[model samples]
Target: MQTFVTEAVDWPDTAPALRERVRALVAEHGERDQVRRANSWTKPDPQFSRKLGKAGLLGMTWPKEYGGHERSQLERYVAIEELLAAGAPVGAHWIADRQSGPLLLRLGNEELKRRWVPAIARGEAFACIGLSEPGSGSDLASVRTAARRDGDGWVLDGQKVWTTGAHVSHFMIALVRTEAGSERQKGLSQLVVPMDTPGVTVKPIVDLTGAHEFNEVFFDQVRLPGSALLGTEGEGWKQATAELSLERSGPERYLSSMVLFLELVRHASVHRNPELDMLVGRLAAEAWTLRLMSASVAAKLARGEDPALEATMVKDLGNSYEQAIPQLVQAAVDFGSPDNEVLRAVCFYLLQVSPSFSLRGGTREIVKGIIARGLGLR
Candidate 1:
């Protein structure tokens, strides 16, 4: 019998000062009520992103040569935790700072890194993931997007669906099949495809929330220079698999409804409802525990370790807890004293959008399968 355990983490003493700095920065974004910044990582706002970049809060872990501050990943977490908790608008730089920039620093060649990493760190260029497809939702190995080798470049001709922010992004770190006859997960290669390349089209995909956070991007004989290839040929599967550690385990996994959580607490306090206050306390405990679990995962990633099973665990359980926040808020308000117009509006919006918490990153079923495999149950 395998026993799963999460070791307790001792946060660095510097964390308090770092959090205060980020808190002061977040305070500058004032009037969160007007913006509704919940889940703002998926809601792009270039101006806000640029401000974060100028503040030197985006790329906290990378080398200073590429416009980074070379700060520890824990400090980065401090800044991001404060940003997400305050519902700051960070969507524009979220993907670039979180995944793409790091992926480039790890895999890209000198020229490729020099060209994109600085701009990414500066929040000058935006990016979107081109992994999911119309027919291949979570089964990424079955992606149908193909990139055929041309004389000195590649001609990509396929469609990538459910690409978040593709319509507004300047680039896509796409995974395409380079070897036509190769089987699943083989012959796959990662490429940096410029969105402005001719024959590339982006069709917006609106979700149930009446928001356009997804897009179906089509490549009709789109051409990319040979340098666009990231890492090595036929190695994209490995690169992509390794890259998901950040996507699945970060603070974003649990903070999707943080704004709503804060608002719910404020409403409960105003009414002095014991039941609602109890729910808030329970939820706060859950968030604190999950943060420690997630911080453990971050520590591993900082050391260049994947910790796949641990990251998957954080995402699966954290998303469930995040999804429940808005539901609990709605129930609390419905059963007790109602909230004012502002709190009610936040509750309704989070209630509408929280369903996606489990969908993105990876579904609960998919993640649990990984956990089962890691525990030798598969």
Candidate 2:
């Protein structure tokens, strides 16, 4: 693959101070029990989100004129790493804070930015991405959702599967075909549709872990005003391509499985086996590498460059590490009894959830295809 690492911007001098501030905030509200009690992998507590907003932690990259702190992306990244590492309930504001807000800032009309950016930064508004449809894993061009231009708006009709936070989000950044598909990436457009729009419905999808995180959202001739469209018509494919890089590379990629890693490492240290120690060392090294790769992407993004291929590499490798945690840990940690409820429960939870790490955001096959295309090997 064409290595897409832009010249690394010097780590912002402000990064350490911001990291310390975020770390302090985490220390104040951080609790393992609270994290365990959080129900959905995709939904976050509204109260927690408000608290984050009050702490001036949201909208780290937007301009100050828009109620943002105007911090560099690297600083924003450090804040996210601290939040995810501490297992904070950031799900409610995650999509809005990370992808939707930044996207709107880029392509939204002035009215849209003025109306939504402050609310998003304040955590009073939340958003979700409505990109995937049934059997359309990363094949965004194949989406069947159709939105026909009406007199002053558009009528949308389609279903989106595995839509995280769809049930509770105030808005969804939806992709739909605005024209016939012959143009390939053309003829596609993105719209910011309110979840409360008439004819919209969200149904929960329970996973093996009994988590109600993903959902199937249906739009039945939903009427949206012209203002709801995000960017110029037929520009969604380009917009979404850039946005996926934001999704694919980040602290969330590796930190989701960190609690499990800590548990496994603790078990190994107590048992003190050479094999387990070696494996832990290797995993830690990989984790550090992912951090460096992610940091490089953050630096590039800060410089107004999109390092899409580099971000995909981080996601691909980072997610593999996430999935491997349960298997490798399972092999290393042998409970005295296979039927031991404590050990069995942890094992079952990790195994059931590991599959989701690779599936969400983008699948392994889809990521590899992107990498291949970058290399001109396809």
Q: Score each candidate by Cα lDDT.
A: 0.84, 0.80
**Candidate 1 residue lDDT tens string, 35-152:** 3677867777787777778888888888999989998887888788788877777787788899999999989989889988889878788889889987788888998899998999
Task: Give the C-alpha lDDT of model 1.
Answer: 0.84
Writing each residue's lDDT as its tens digit, candidate 2 over 1-378 gives 237654544776877887788778767765455325222235477887887888889997788888898877877887888777666778888999989999999999987899889989888899989889995767778888889989998999999998988877999999888886545687899988889999999999998868787799999999998898899888889898888888888878876766666666766766788998898898889878877888888887777877778888888888888788768867767666544444445555767777878878878898999888887786
The alpha-carbon root-mean-square deviation between model 1 and the true structure, to one decimal in Å, is 1.8
Give the range where candidate 1 is weakest over 10 consecutive residues by summed lDDT: 1-10
Q: After superposition, which runs of candidate 1 have C-alpha atoms over 4 Å from their true positions?
A: 1-5, 8-10, 335-339
**In model 1, how many backbone clashes occur?**
0
Q: Backbone clashes per model, in order?
A: 0, 1
Clashing pairs in 1: none
